[model samples]
Target: MRTNSPETKKTARELRNDPVLSKEYTKNKIQFQNYYFKLGYQWSKPDLNSIVCRFAVLIQVIRIKREELTESFIEYDTRFLGGNFQIPDSKELLLLIFLNAPLYQVFTTLRKCSKRKEKYYKDRVGQRFEIQIGYE
Candidate 1:
């Protein structure tokens, strides 16, 4: 896990202020704070339910090395409320392959390079990728 630096603080602030968040704080505040504490965050007074804090915690959880994620655990698609919709694990495998594939890398690189005004693509991309993947 990465250390909590200025970048982390900035990210936390951004998450706290994100307008699209549901505005609901987590019920398990202490446990949430403790989780981040274990991951090296030093929050003076953390809001567990805050979107940013929750997002940070989620990032640490899912960013575990790819090898650590087990394929044996069955995942269900509960889209149609109460409907028994099960998706094949292959869907997840395909997504993982695409994300790690060279073609996706090339597409992302080209997209970043084409943005003439933005010189901080690496930082932006890192944060964007984290948020996008975390949400998905």
Candidate 2:
């Protein structure tokens, strides 16, 4: 797993120093809310990662254990989006986490994951993956 713990370490320092990052974060939050208001697929929202992290924190505040967060996500997904995903659905969760996680934490986690992937195989950076549908 990528290490996002570094982000947690810098949270106080970043909050104290950078007004720009803070403004960007606040702007993203509003964009996320507007996306939800439009009734777009929840996946289309921009600040999904932050939302996920927020939910994790919320669960803790509600006296739920961190160990139960995955199960809670499953429950929340089923209730809001119809059913639990067959595979781990981190795309949406990542978006929420990114938004909710401290900026430094998000970047660190992404960097670690990228490095780990590179260690296993040569990656084609900028390669595009697409899907095409044929209708009869």
Candidate 3:
């Protein structure tokens, strides 16, 4: 008989609780807080739970989809993003895909992220992260 392997991350909540995730998000505490900023709640308030949770889920989904598409893990670069622009999740993975993947994979990798609307993020983040890397 055969069995499937377990998921590395079942949900965003699990990732959020991870010490590594905590360390990365905490780099710019204020920015993370602002991601869920509520008029009255602000940071350190229980009222912000759902809002923060939503972003957490989004983060988890994006990371997962990107990984699945790339067929490899990705991570934020320790060095500053080479371009003048900065996004919350560094474009390190995108660069790796563009530079290394086959043309078809590269096109798919680039297109997958923007296939949806209402998820465009244009900003800088200092969070640090590293995901496993291997080419299939």
List TM-score per model, in order.
0.18, 0.20, 0.16
Candidate with maximal lDDT: 2
Residue pairs with backbone atoms closer than 3 Å in model 3 (clashes): none
Best by TM-score: 2
Q: What is candidate 2's lDDT per residue for 1-136, written digit by digit as tens?
A: 3355777657857875786655433211111212121122356455533333321111110112333456545444333233342423233222122212233222101111233444322232222111111220
Cα RMSDs, all models: 17.0, 16.0, 17.9
Q: Write the per-residue lDDT of candidate 1 for residues 20-98, one digit (tens) a residue.
A: 6523432211111122232222365454343222222111112123233444422211122223234333322211101
Worst 10 residues of 2 by lDDT: 54-63
Order of candidate numbers by TM-score, starting with the best = 2, 1, 3
Model 2 CA deviation exceeding 4 Å by range: 1-70, 77-80, 89-96, 100-136
TM-score winner between candidates 1 and 2: 2
Model 1 misplaced stretches (Cα beyond 4 Å): 22-24, 27-136
Candidate 2 TM-score versus the reference: 0.20
* Model 3 TM-score, all chains together: 0.16
